[model samples]
Target: MKKNYGYARVSSKEQNLDRQIEALTNYGINERDIITDKQSGKDFNRTGYVTLKNQLLRSGDTLVIKELDRLGRNMDMIKKEWQELQENRINIIVLDTPLLNTEGKSDLEKKLISNIVFELLSYMAEKERIKIKERQAEGIKKAKEKGKHLGRPKAKYPKLWEMYYFQWKSGQITAKECMEQLDLKRTTFYKLAKDYESKLIK
Candidate 1:
């Protein structure tokens, strides 16, 4: 009475889930037993994945995915979840990695091999993630050194800022009045005033 369940995932809406779905279906999994999520693999909090794990899947059921990373991106969390599934007696098959498959094998040697392969792959995945982050940090630092803006560009100073700033500073106009005249928020007005004053001092 073991059922075959397939899971498919795409990190963003722009990416198509068709490839994963096709692979699952071609593997002979029933359409009803295939669940998909259009969300990041960073976590297992996705609705489709959660529903499969909590409600649909049961002991002795086989869970198949196109790849290990489809389950999650975090190596530690992936290992924890894999252990949990193993403890629950649920089988897993990664289509891209035959060595990691836990299906149709009851032999101790096979199990040991699978464990070794899983550990090595998980470690490599985590290391790759760390390298990517380091590369990103380095790129951002270089961009900053080149005088490129990182985040959103600073808002441009409104026209008539000099007139409004002088009036506000001399108490000829209230802060709210200056903001209203310039159609700017109080914070923006104050920030522009400070920048203007700094320019004058320089």
Candidate 2:
């Protein structure tokens, strides 16, 4: 017999899944059939989702999610999983997007709906990536204005850095010669020189 199952997800344990759970239950799905995970939507390595897909769902079963993003935020993975489910003859019902519900739909209707959903999801995922990049760039700019160092903390200079740095600065030794003596990379040697100068300014 065909069955209905629900899946819920939250990025963190602290995030509430009540709304999703409620929606699934309101859709008349039993609580026991609902699988949930509290982890990232970055990838689908989630325990609940994996178990549900691998162990529980069978051909003719319907999977329910409150929102498309509850399935995943990764557009590529989402499409991949959707294709797999379709190949397995399982159905999907996205509660928030009524038109995306596949239960009781004919093959032609399902294909049309899937295409629309895929296009919409792709658009959303791209916009999300751009917004995240913009926010990160803004944050970096603010941090720089505040004189905060970003990314990895600087490595401590080699034991001979001070001596080599002075020799290099005074033209007593070439930059390459100083780096070879101090066992520093080209970039690290220059960065150390800049830091030493900053310390002198302080």
Top candidate by TM-score: 2
User: Tens-digit lDDT track for model 1 on 114-158?
Assistant: 588577766888889999999999999999899999987877888
Please provide, for model 2 over 93-196, each residue's C-alpha lDDT reduced to its tens digit, 9 standing for 90 to 100.
98988888888999999899889988987898899999999999999999999999999987798897777788888999999999899888988878888888
TM value for model 2: 0.69
Candidate 2 off by > 4 Å:
40-44, 140-202
Runs with alpha carbons beyond 4 Å of true place in candidate 1? 40-44, 107-114, 133-202
Best by lDDT: 2
lDDT of 1 at 188: 78
Clash statistics: count for each candidate: 0, 0
lDDT score for candidate 2 against the true structure: 0.88
